[model samples]
Target: MADKQDLNAGFTGTPVEQPEGLAKAAQSAASRVKREAYAVTAGARDHPHTASALLLGIGIAAFGFGYLLGRSSAESSASYWR
Candidate 1:
C-alpha cells in the first residue's frame, strides 16, 4: 500500500520540472515566427506601394465600422428615452 502511494508521490506537485521536449517545441515555434516576420518585412520593403494601399483600405474599413456602431447606439438611446 505504501509503495503504491509513493508511486504517484513525484506527481503530487512537490517540485515541478519542465520536460526537454516541451522546451524544444517552444524554441521551434519561436524560430518559425521570427522567420515569418522577417519574410513579411522583406516583402513590405520590396513593395511599398502595395503595403500602403493595404494599410489605407484597412483604415477606411475600420472607420466605417466605427461610424455604423456609433450611429446604431445613438438611435437605440433615442428610442429608449421615448
Candidate 2:
C-alpha cells in the first residue's frame, strides 16, 4: 500500500508505450463516417408515397399509444384484485 501511494504521488517513470491496433481503430472510425454520409445522401429524397406512408405509420403508432393509455385503467383495476 505504501508503494502504491508513492507511485500515485508523482510521475517517476519513462513514458509507457501505446498498445497496437491504433491504425485499425482510426480506420474503423473513418468507415463509420462513410456509412453515415451514405445514409444521409440516400435518404435525402422523400417521394410523395414515402411521405404518406411515414405519416400513416406515425398516426397508427399514436392511436395505438392512446388505446394503451385508455386500457391502463382496466389494467390497474385488475391488479387491485390480484
Candidate 3:
C-alpha cells in the first residue's frame, strides 16, 4: 500500500485560504435566511386560513398551467390516421 504522503506528492498546488470577509458574509446571509424562514412560519401559523387559501390558489394555477402545456404538446404530435 502507498503512504498518504506518497499519494499526495503528485499534486504541488498550494493550499488556498478563504477571505475573512467571505466567511462573515456567508454567516450573515445564513442568519438572515433563518430569520426570514422563522418569520414566514410564524405568519403562516397566525393566519392559517390565508395560508391555506394561498396554497389552494397556487395549486389550481399550477394544475391549469400543466394541463395547458400537456394539451399543446399533444396537439403538436397528434396522428392524422385516427
TM-score computed on alpha carbons, candidate 1: 0.60
lDDT tens digits, residue span 1-82, model 3: 9987668656577548654798879978999999999999999999999999999999999999999999988887786435
Ranking by TM-score: 3, 1, 2
RMSD from true fold, candidate 1: 12.7
Considering summed lDDT, which 10 consecutive residues are worst modelled in model 2?
A: 40-49
Using TM-score, give the best candidate's number.
3
lDDT of each prediction vs. the true structure?
Answer: 0.88, 0.79, 0.88
Root-mean-square deviation per candidate? 12.7, 12.3, 9.6
Which runs of model 1 end up more than 4 angstroms from their true locations?
Answer: 1-26
> After TM-score superposition, what is the CA distance of residue 55 in candidate 2 from its true location, in Å?
0.3
What does the lDDT read for residue 69 in candidate 2? 92
Model 2 Cα displacement at 1 (Å)? 99
